[model samples]
Target: MARTRCDRTPAWAQLQLAYDNSGKAFDLRQAFAQDAGRFEAFSQSAPYVFADLSKNRIDAATDKLLFDLARQSGLQEHRDAMFAGEKINHTEGREVWHVLLRTPPESSQDGSHRSVELAKVHETLNAMLAFAESVRSDSGITDVVNIGIGGSDLGPQMAVIALDAFATTGKRLHFVSNVDGHELAATLKTVKADSTLFLIASKTFTTIETMTNARSAKAWFEAQGGTDTARHFAALTTNVAAANAFGITTTFGFWDWVGGRYSLWSAIGLPLAIAIGAQGFREFLAGAHAMDEHFRTAPLEQNLPVRLGLLDLWYRNFHGFTSRSIAPYHSALRRLPAYLQQLEMESNGKRVDAEGAALPFGTSPVLWGEPGTNGQHAYFQMLHQGTDVVPLEFVAVKKPRHALASHHTLLLANVLAQAQALMVGKVDAGGHKHFPGNRPSTFLLLDDLTPASLGALIALQEHRVFVSGSLWGINSFDQWGVELGKVLAKDVEARLGSGDTTGLDGSTAGLLARLRA
Candidate 1:
């Protein structure tokens, strides 16, 4: 289906007019005072997550216009194209079906056209879970080291820590992604080679950072008299030939449709599966699948992802907010902002549209943040009184897993108070103490940060990103920007040893000399 770019739509003109008329000076406090049902009108419940979007700089009129923008932009059809297994990621000529990774076999069978692909998905999922179970039951394996970068590293590492309470196995899961030998070396020092199971998790088995760490890990294992590479090391990769060459027999493979940032639900989730057990892993998938169904079938007016995505556009395009701060109130979700940075930035940080045409508007907002309370001390001051209005997102869990009632109460109170303080700023006669109220924020709450809720939350973010990217008419699945840096780094690495300055720019040559010095 031919998609309409957001700026070219009739609704876009109305939105521009709306923003110019009142959106530029839109006051959250005034909006609330004027509209009695604003909170209920904006708040939405979807799957395992409930969102309070009332505090955002939007009203009923702008929301309706945004819904029209979604319709005019062909977001519904574009989203359907992805779920239908079309090669929507035209750059790579692959279907963007990370959603399929979470789909149940019975539900997947409903899409008869994708039976073959669905079969492959379940086959790999079953095998991966079986392997995870084996590792979980293995008492000898005291440590599980996952060697991968990007999706392989961030997704699994974040999930493992977030689901630490659910980990049945006593095994410590270590993720080494950075090519910096310090991270891998430090992790290796803590675990003995004999009791450690290394999972190499690059799809091609040749990601430079992953392979570098894998090679070092292998050498350390062999040096420490650790034999049985087949038992000690497994490959979560499609390249069986490369795995065999590297002395790894156990391999789990996912499809080409699964891109790196979105590969968490694929075999890349083995570390998480081992940590939380097969049942928990399945629950995680089920939770995400529920969100997927909501995104697929729900009306635009009632859709959580649609509402959030349109709000993102309202902030970025009209409000001219260049950044969004993600403050997960839970300590376990400390890495969430970092993971989302990659998920959103890498997915939609393109300068061009899907057809390679340069975009006239901004795409992704710079997503950055730390866990809350910590952020309250550090950057919360800047957020409260800063010149630029960076929209803040606060993620809070209603229930705590721990029995510390007072601590949990304090945590919940802080989250609520912070959101309130952002909106209802205290008026001070002194200029330094004055806080301009009506700062926008979106509050996301989960009943508990279990595997199911975590899965739903992550999936909600994924689809929300897709909604924005779809309207912007960009290929959300591709990350061509990251390749140029990698390609340049290879040449720089080679130049460091050879002292070859040929074709090197002045800055590169100068930096090379300084580094060598």
Candidate 2:
């Protein structure tokens, strides 16, 4: 039972056969014109998500071969290994269990594997939620500022703004991630020192940018005659001793199994909890938990994450497509592209396997895009006529969160039109007007972008990452890549302060001189 890559599988040969014989290229126009059931056959509904993959260049035989590839690749074994709490992240000897962070206490059957971890997950979650509720109800707390970088800053900040309409609490939320003094200065100008609460978010309480920003924020607060330091600042770091030494009384800890990119379900989601309150936050977790169960138990052919990941492998390995575009139609979900950029690129952007052997194949693709209509104006032209074949992923909501009906209709129309246009291209008589007709795209429709739906959507992405990582045989959880730069930056920062560039790279020395000047 040696694990196999998709290319080594027998199904890969079948896929190649189908791909070769399926004409010069599988044309979506021809497929739709020939089969009346094209849309119905390609579209699928699972939980809160519905995907319309009809616009893609794939055919019936393509899907069959892809499913066979999934079976032959041992995708099920890799998936189950993760769910069983095996050390799938072999590079760090850690279990990849961000999924467990969202699993509800009641849903875990009495003797299930998840039930064993349920007690600790809920214990921290409950304490964190209680703290969030307390902050929400506090009339003295007019503003909450979160100091973090990467996953710590992105997920909570994005969700809080996305769910602003659902926020009953009137408190304003601010996130400071940059080392630049201007960001903190601008934020501090708007809030009274006595009325603001700052959440210092770093897993180790030692991330240079986070700690620097936290210290600057504290300095500003103290200089402004703020008396109560303990009440005003809390921490979301596992390093309780560091937080205590810094004079913070409250702290929340997450397990090592939770990677920074996948930490939103852990205490990193404290800002979301503060924004939406305890009940809404719990609904978010429950939604993710439901998707976790679905991912863990669903058959490969029927599984949404599995299907999507298999498609990813097909595109990357077989078709040689390099990047995939994510277009979320709703304006509220604008940050989703950025959030996923970190989640996918940071997780699976590895050149080595879990055993640290250099891989012969590609890992994660470069994920970059803005919200729809916006991207339609910006990059859709390149996608329509660009030399490279970039697969598009469109996320559309069935219902609008906003009250503006006209805007929603126009948005939906643009979304539908884009996918339609991608499949059915226009060819004019003139040479410049000849549009290519075989570009591919995937459409994901959500019932709505409620906390529950968003949770499910994000969880689906997490599992998709898992599938791709498993197939690549890489440790997706540990981010050793992010560390080297941090280490280098410290040396550079000291050189910048002291005008010393002894024994540095040519580029580093030159950059140092320019900065010093």
lDDT winner among the candidates? 1
Candidate with best TM-score:
1
In terms of lDDT, model 2 sits at 0.86
Residue pairs whose backbone atoms clash in candidate 1: none
**lDDT of all predictions, in order shown?**
0.93, 0.86
Candidate 2 worst ten-residue window by lDDT: 1-10
What are the per-residue Cα lDDT tens digits for candidate 2 across 1-517? 2467655779977877776787237788888999999999888877789988778777777888888777777878888787778877777888888878886677545876667677888999999999999999899999999999999999998788778878899999999999888998899999999999999999999998999999999998999999788999999998999999988999999988888888999999999999998999998988888888888888776788988887887788767788999998888888999999998999889998766778888889999899988998899988888788899999998887668659989998999988888778888888577678688899999988888888889999999988887777777787888889889888887889998889988998998899778
In model 1, the runs with Cα more than 4 Å from the true position are 107-113
RMSD for all candidates, in order, please: 1.2, 1.9
TM-score (all chains, Cα) for each model: 0.98, 0.96
lDDT of 1 at 74: 99
